[model samples]
Target: MQPLLSSYSSSSSLTIFLVSLLLVGDHGGARIILPANVTVPAVIAFGDSIMDQGANNNLNTLAKANFAPYGKDSVAGIPTGRFSNNRTPADMLVEQMGIKEFMPAYLDPSLDDKELLTGVSFASAGSGFDPQTPNLLGVLSFADQLDQFKEYIEKLKGIVGEERTQYILTNSLFLVVAGSNDLANTYFTIGIRKLQYDIPSYSNLMVSSASNFIKDIYKLGARRIVVFNAPPVGCLPLQRTLSGNEHRMCAEKHNKAAQLYNNKLQAELKHLHNTLAESKIVNIDIYKPLLAIMKNPKQYGLEVVDRGCCGTGNIEVAILCNRLLPTCLDASKYLFWDSFHPTEKGYNILMNEVVGRHASDWF
Candidate 1:
């Protein structure tokens, strides 16, 4: 399979491809099901709330989304700390790969030894690559997450022995989705970082932190790692509402910072690829596609792009987006479910872009 849609460019072509892949069945008159021929043995996730399945629920943090309307359209129809109204990119990616239904939160006490073999997410809500970002928000730091990953490896070794564990570690797909919080929450916010460093310097610090995290994971036996660059932070509903003034325009300054960080991150990943033998450190640009979606909402069947589906969508997120506030009846019409996060429908579009971009790498 030399990538299913290597030549397709238009959205109509993409839609046709999707139906053929997801809906069409075999000629035997039964639903055509295939075995999961996943390239990796497992998919480990480490990042911020964008990839946080339900890790924050176990932590003593103010950033939590394990409540009603959050999981309004999830597989179980129950909130599991995902910021979206339904399944996230993490959920969609693994399923499309035919690996598993959903990646469970690593901190979930109910996770058994067997489940550890597939994979679990270590991402926490409000976390950032910056050490102080998580600390400031009272969430798990990236450093802490890495330590947890180390411990997870040890536990896996105990369960399946060292040989199998090594194989799993080397073959697993490590997903790193962070840095948005560092720029959007910590640096841009009226905090110590703003007083200490300029946008360029702060972005450099983020790149350094992210680069170190990648190197550490590589040393820990990760081989296939996909690091998602930060999305357009300025376009986020919260940022727009905060700085958009009365007209509610996007904060271009924040978007520029996001681009700066992404450029640096891509350069760092390329350097890692050249230096770290057997390590596949890939950089995925999410901002471009996401920006297109926001710019042309009609192209993606969306109506509300300036606000979120959860309450006002201006500033509410995590705990602030509570059950007391009524949610949008049609989440599909909105790009964001909350102030900063995309709705499940929005995430679905993102997943399509990811798969289209990285299908060759996965296959």
Candidate 2:
């Protein structure tokens, strides 16, 4: 698919293709979907806050959402350690796929019959590829998330037998969203910045860890993978608020580092797709679409661009994202829900871009 896009030297042809495809689809009653042979039976999310939902319940860290006003609009209006007030992309993905609700987070002890069989989230807020990054934020590290996954697998084997568990692995959706915390604490914060490895070296380390994690999932029976490239972290509200210079410029140095990481990740996924012939790995370009909105929020009729609706919107994210600080009167006008996340509307736009890739229509 990327090769076909490359044929059109300039991106103009790519836009032409989008238009042509839509025109043709409108003419026909049926639209092209994901490959007909594709099958997604369960969803297994691993990584960070972007996909976490109360998974950190068992962790002793400050990163938790099992409280209130979090997931407030969602099932029971209960905080689910999701770092948000409602369902996240991980949950949303499973819903779109027509799967049962996202598997329960690996932590919740109340785990019973239904939740255990559906799917689960191993994601943790503040979790990152680099182990040290989570320290500053006091959240689960990425490696810990994997340990959680292992436990889930072990339990599933108990419930559904090892042979059937293997079948579950080969047919589930493994979705990942991480790296922002690494960029924020490791590079943006002055302390971690002091011993910073060069951008290239850091990116290599990230790619290596992430790729290995993907391979581990493949070995465990995950055949369909939807991998998300890190978003343009430097452009996020948290960064903008912390920049302190008043100009909402993204930390370019950090963004470049993230870009280098994404570039490598793309190549690695292509390689993985080839090597794991029995599975399908999809790379969802989260950075590009969000960047488009960041650069031109007015195009989307978004007014509050640099700051989040949560009060001052400066450097206040996660547990700090609240009205105890300066908050916007109407959050809908803002792009970010908290300093680090998106409003429901913002998520809707992101979903449009991401879901298309999962569909057969695009990638």
Candidate 3:
């Protein structure tokens, strides 16, 4: 096989093209032989819609997007409840690591023992660290996701036996991406937490919740864990729409809140890494990259930064972004695919940056 690096002009382009290939199949695309060395045995994802592969499809949640126009650029050309046109960050990271091109949803009925051996995503759409977040959408909470993970381990035990399951759990890469919904959707939109706690107090709650989650998973034999910081939710199309003014911009207050929470979360992660035995808890700063894209769309080959590709691009998402609604002709030009989610192209760019800048140090 030809070297993928030589074939592509840049890493970002390589990542984007490779993700498309992964989604559809090689389809006569470059087939670069991945290095024999595997970084992590598997990548187990836990979070909200950002990482959800299709877990919400099986649930009676209103946050589902398993229909047409959602996966317009995907290989299957059908919605897979991924919250993107194609694969997500989870899929990109897993594929980039040579674990698998596609990580199946743990809740999918067709999930087999073979797929479980490599990896599977346990994330659910509309989930968050705060219980109220999921409660609002009738989706899984952080605790509920943890419970599902526990159930997954039991199932793994049955498939690969106790010892192998333990080995996989200890060696695999555990990705936790929460809090975005907690702040953006739950606290801000619903105002339930605002009535009880102030911004600082609420951010502290998010940090505490994240710490508990990391510690719990560490106790469960997870050694390599990557937790994502909340992005600039204020920059999301929905939030911008809520700004009301015709000349709306990224909400500064919300962005500031995200930065504060991220600072606290990073400090907590560093402390956890120092304390946890044999654990490598790493923090992935999602805010900076995402914010950069929003600031300079041309820098990332994106034309539209303020709105999404689906329908009105301001507030429509999930159920509202149906097949009947007109979507952008080329999703690649748009930074966001929906009101709250990044486009598949945007995810590819993020994945490339993340793997290039961060993964080398950890792996």
Candidate 4:
């Protein structure tokens, strides 16, 4: 399949046409067809708000997004705790894999046995590889999420026989998206980690934690894994509003920190891929593609790049972006739903490229 974005240009008419095409259905762009060699029976996810489906809804944390204007564009037209205006990347990934239309959150009480077999997201909105990141926000830590995965495994074994459960686990596509919160929130915005370690050392800590998480899951039976690198956190609307100059340019320092972590993470994943037995661990580069769209929004048929579609688009996110505030008339024109998360259309664009370019590597 060809890439969604094969070239970049500034033609207004072309941008308008592409934007129209992107807003066609629940998710835009051409559908992804898996290769004959691949067999993704399930698509499991773990990480922060980027991959969070609704795991934060019941948590007593400000990271929740189960209210208003959050799911205005959803099929049901009600908030589902996703950080986006509609479906999240987790949901999109499952759909792209042809396993299911939506991936349920592991914490959602309504999940049935069928959904469990398809896969679920254990991600919390404010979570990071850093244990303290979720502790500070009262959301599920990586350890807590891992514990939830263990519980899920037991439940799956109860539903299906041990052999089938193992088959499902071994064939499922495991997506690990994290480290953004560690750099953007814990280290830079919160400034707590700065007191402990500088950029390189903290990157090491994140890499080590991520490595352990991968190994832990590998031991549990996961073989086909995709580890997403940190996005350009500096370009996020929240970062720009906080650290950008009067013009609110992308925060170069924050981007640098994210790049540092991504480089370390790529190297670590490479090492793990070589060492792990019968494992296919690949690092997906979210930073470059996202930065490309941010640098030239029109290339992706998006208008607002520096800000988001909700409220002032500068600092509002999670609880701050609520029903009381008016959202943009057309969120499809915007790249972000809130200060910290992408809109459904933006995620579709990104996922289209991701599944097209890298989905085959897992096999």
RMSD of each: 11.6, 12.0, 10.4, 9.4
Listed in order, each prediction's TM-score against the native is 0.88, 0.83, 0.89, 0.92
lDDT of 2 by residue, 126-190 (tens): 67777776665556666677776788789889999998788778776678777776665565553
On TM-score, the stronger of 2 and 4 is 4
Per-residue lDDT for 170-191 in model 1, tens only? 8888999988778776776534
Could you tell me the lDDT of residue 363 within candidate 4?
76
Global Cα lDDT for candidate 3: 0.77
The lDDT for every candidate, in the order shown, is 0.78, 0.65, 0.77, 0.82
- Candidate 2 lDDT at 28 equals 11
Task: Tell me the spans in candidate 4 whose CA falls farther than 4 Å from its real position.
Answer: 1-26
Per-residue lDDT for 192 in model 3? Answer: 79
Better of 1 and 4 by TM-score: 4
Is candidate 1 or 2 superior in TM-score?
Answer: 1
lDDT of 1 at 149: 97
Candidate 4 backbone collisions, by pair: none
Worst 10 residues of 4 by lDDT: 16-25
Q: Using alpha carbons, what is the TM-score of model 4?
A: 0.92
Candidate that would win on lDDT: 4
lDDT of 4: 0.82
Per-prediction tally of clashes: 0, 12, 0, 0
